[model samples]
Target chain A: MFAQSLVGAAAAVAAHLETLLAEHQALPVVEAMGYATRGGKALRGYLVLESARLHGVPEGHAIWPACAIEAVHAYSLVHDDLPCMDDDDLRRGLPTVHRKWDEATAVLAGDALQALGFELVSDPRCHPSGEVRADLALSLARAAGARGMVMGQALDMAAEATDVPLDLAQITALQAGKTGALIRWSAEAGARLAEVDPAPLTAYADRLGLAFQIADDILDVEGDAAMMGKAVGKDAGRGKATFVSLLGLDTAKLRARQLVDEACDALSPYADRAENLRAAARFVISRSN
Target chain B: MFAQSLVGAAAAVAAHLETLLAEHQALPVVEAMGYATRGGKALRGYLVLESARLHGVPEGHAIWPACAIEAVHAYSLVHDDLPCMDDDDLRRGLPTVHRKWDEATAVLAGDALQALGFELVSDPRCHPSGEVRADLALSLARAAGARGMVMGQALDMAAEATDVPLDLAQITALQAGKTGALIRWSAEAGARLAEVDPAPLTAYADRLGLAFQIADDILDVEGDAAMMGKAVGKDAGRGKATFVSLLGLDTAKLRARQLVDEACDALSPYADRAENLRAAARFVISRSN
Candidate 1:
């Protein structure tokens, strides 16, 4: 049921965003960007729509911010896969942006998409107050830029030293930056779009983001590349620091469950529309990819 | 006198933006960003102030946005110099951000500074309205992101083969991505912050950015490495396309003058405040570094 709901909500988001990102001006780039963006787990969007649902946010209100989140998330992936960055050539069973276009095009596409993400959040139709839109813009900017993703990547770059053996706290910080930061912000941004109190669920997102990372670590060990369309055991092969390495597989699996419970607990206060979000957290831990 | 004003204005920008950037939650990262940011020549800031002066914008009105523009420009340089990108270890006569802090920290600082630049623009303290600031933020975001500097870097990377003699238009587009686009937007954004007609002066900036590239091409042939603080003649050595290579040094110099003159002509309607901007056009050709 939760899996089906995630698909339903994500489809809703894609359907809504398709018109906004329709081909024009630089249509090829936009079309390429759309191709790169679709086929994500839609976990972040699910959390957003779920939170909106729990809070009784009117349908269609949260779509813009949800699309904005996905854009940023996808753009980050494109740049992150560059030869200089994560260097991955495959994502979600498709050629990475750099592989699809030249490296320059991928880099440019990612950069444009990042700016496009900010532009979307500030769309006059979605965010009424330029001030508030700017605020949201600021949030996405910081979360995706150096203070967040770039820093996490830098840490990942130097992680092979083994001296940087990350403890639980350090691991969590990286996760917060690498994956959780965006996820948490997606929910918060969606809530803020409706002018709702995000403080009520910010912690929920924190817990959920870490949960996502832990689950990812588990999947790397257990999943198949053909099925997952992502390199299996990449974390281990890279000698990168991960919770499973730091905590052992049993501990990491248990920790993921603990985080899932905390994430659900945080959402309990906003149970109405948040039901989807709550179920999404449970699904995060169990998904194959 | 113009040179003196430019230097003094840059110093002033460095001082004012310090306070704004200091308010970040991560102070070390913030200070490192400051280090990466503080040393700019303030040419872009001068354009903003001078452009505003052309329109008779009040002197006090220029400080915040002027500082903001410089901050944004500095942040772009900091990120651009990373090992994954330009890989330069030096900037503005000082060690680059990645050198000062670890790479991760450097990336974070750059990201934070970029976010901060937009945040400053959004606040009424810098510009008047959310509507205007949103546009301001959008303009900066579009020009600086992957499609702009990052894309340009990727192009440079792709062009690193033994030979790829680009035609004049391709060279222009490459330079536009690398050096021209941001400069063009810088002047436009400065005008936008002043709440004036940026279109007229943008022509000047377009010419100026192109002129700046032509001048850079000329310098590569004639410049001393000690003075340039960057590799000199590396373009030719690498067989990269450049104005000097495409049009020859003498023609490149002539094109630069024509561009500068055209830039000046674009500002004919408002001659008084355009003095520094005009001086900047001259500076682009004349500066040793």
Candidate 2:
């Protein structure tokens, strides 16, 4: 049931993005934007939809933020794959944006995608209350900007340039910004939309985000390249310190499981309505990719 | 008087941006964001401030949108200076962001700056009305997104790759998106904040934008590189079709003056209160850089 719901959320978000991008079909950058946004697991979007459902927010109102997060995720991937950044040629089983088109197109497409994310959330159709829309845009900017995702990325790049490996605490801080911030935002979005206190969701997301990163580290060690659709074992190849590197593989897996349990427990306020989110936490550790 | 007010606006905007950025001072990308934003003419910010004054909006409220536009402008310049884009080495008499920092830092800084733009406008402090803040964010996104500035940039890149020179109308449409959209947004911001019709400001800005671009083309042909603070005659060197190229130097200058006159005339509704904006239109054609 969780798997089917996740698929449904992805399809809904993709369709919405398609409609948005279709208005600018003539531009190559727009086409590139469309290309970059396609085919993600849409985990972030699923988090948005499931969380909104728990709060009884209409899907129409929820989908905008769902698509918004996916756009942001797509943008980060496009830019992270650029020659000057990660320089990955393949992503999601296809050539990266820079590989398929050119660096300029990749850069501009990434930029436009980011802008589209803000546009989606702040749009009047996103909610009836202008305050809600404004709040969404503001929080999203904070999550994605220098103090959050970009700061995390900068730290990651800095770490790679040095010989000294990061300890567990440092690595955790970095990943919290890089991956954890957006995931937390996605999980907290429904409560924000409903104008309710987001403490429970925030607690839920913090654990979920840490678990997600740990799972990613484990996948890098054990996952198949064909199944992952991108390069695996890159962390070890770069001599980068990750959860798997600091802790033993067994310890990392044990830690991830603990995080998932904590994440699920935090959702108890919603009781059974959060089953999909609980499943999502389990799936994060179990998925091949 | 006009020059002094413009300088005053720049100082105020810079100080505001500094306060906002100082919170993340430890990050390299945040530092790069500061570097990219410094020393521009702040024409867009001035327009926001001046237009707000005309509409009886508070300077405090106006400054947020002003800083927002400047942030967006900085991000564009940082990305545009990348090796894959214009490959510019110098800007405003200083090394471009990509030249000063690594391409990765430049890219991340630009991304963060773009997020900061939305954050500024959407923050509750920017306006008492949530609808106004949402409107600002939505409009800024549209101006900066695929259908607007990015589309124009893609077109410009496409033009360079092909042997066919863009004709007058095509170049006009291209500039309308490239440089014109942001300018229009900046000029119309105060009216939006005031919740008034932006028709007159839009009219004034449209003519001012065209005149500004024509003047840039004129400067590229006739201006000194040192005075302009960047390379000059590059448009002709690259065989890029510009207003001066298609119309000849004399006609282009004449056309720019004519547009400036129309731009000033469009503000006649405000009478003497718009004298500074009128002078600004003249400055667009007269400035060295």
Candidate with the greatest DockQ versus the true structure: 2
TM-scores for chain A over all candidates: 0.91, 0.97
Candidate 2 docking band: medium
iRMS value of model 1? 4.8
| Fnat per candidate | 0.27, 0.77
User: Residue by residue across B1-289, what tens digits does model 1's lDDT show?
Assistant: 8989888888777877777655544445666877876766888777767766665555466666577667767766766676755678766667787787766466446555665666555555555432434666666666765456544554565566436577898678777877876787767765676667788788999999999988888887898777776667777776778888888777888889999989988877675657778888888888623
lDDT by residue for model 2 (A1-289), tens: 9989999999999999999888884777888898998988899999988888888888998999999999999999999999899999889999999999999999999999999999999986667454535888999999999988988899999899899999999999999899999999999998888889999899989899999999999999998788888888999888899999999799999999999999999989898989999999899888623
DockQ for each model: 0.29, 0.74
lDDT of residue B88 for candidate 1: 80
Model 2 DockQ (Cα-based): 0.74
Query: Which 10-residue window in model 2 chain B sums to the lowest lDDT?
Result: B124-133
Which sections of candidate 1 miss by over 4 Å? A8-35, A49-61, A82-89, A94-109, A128-132, A151-164, A234-241, A245-251, B16-35, B52-68, B71-113, B128-132, B145-165, B238-240
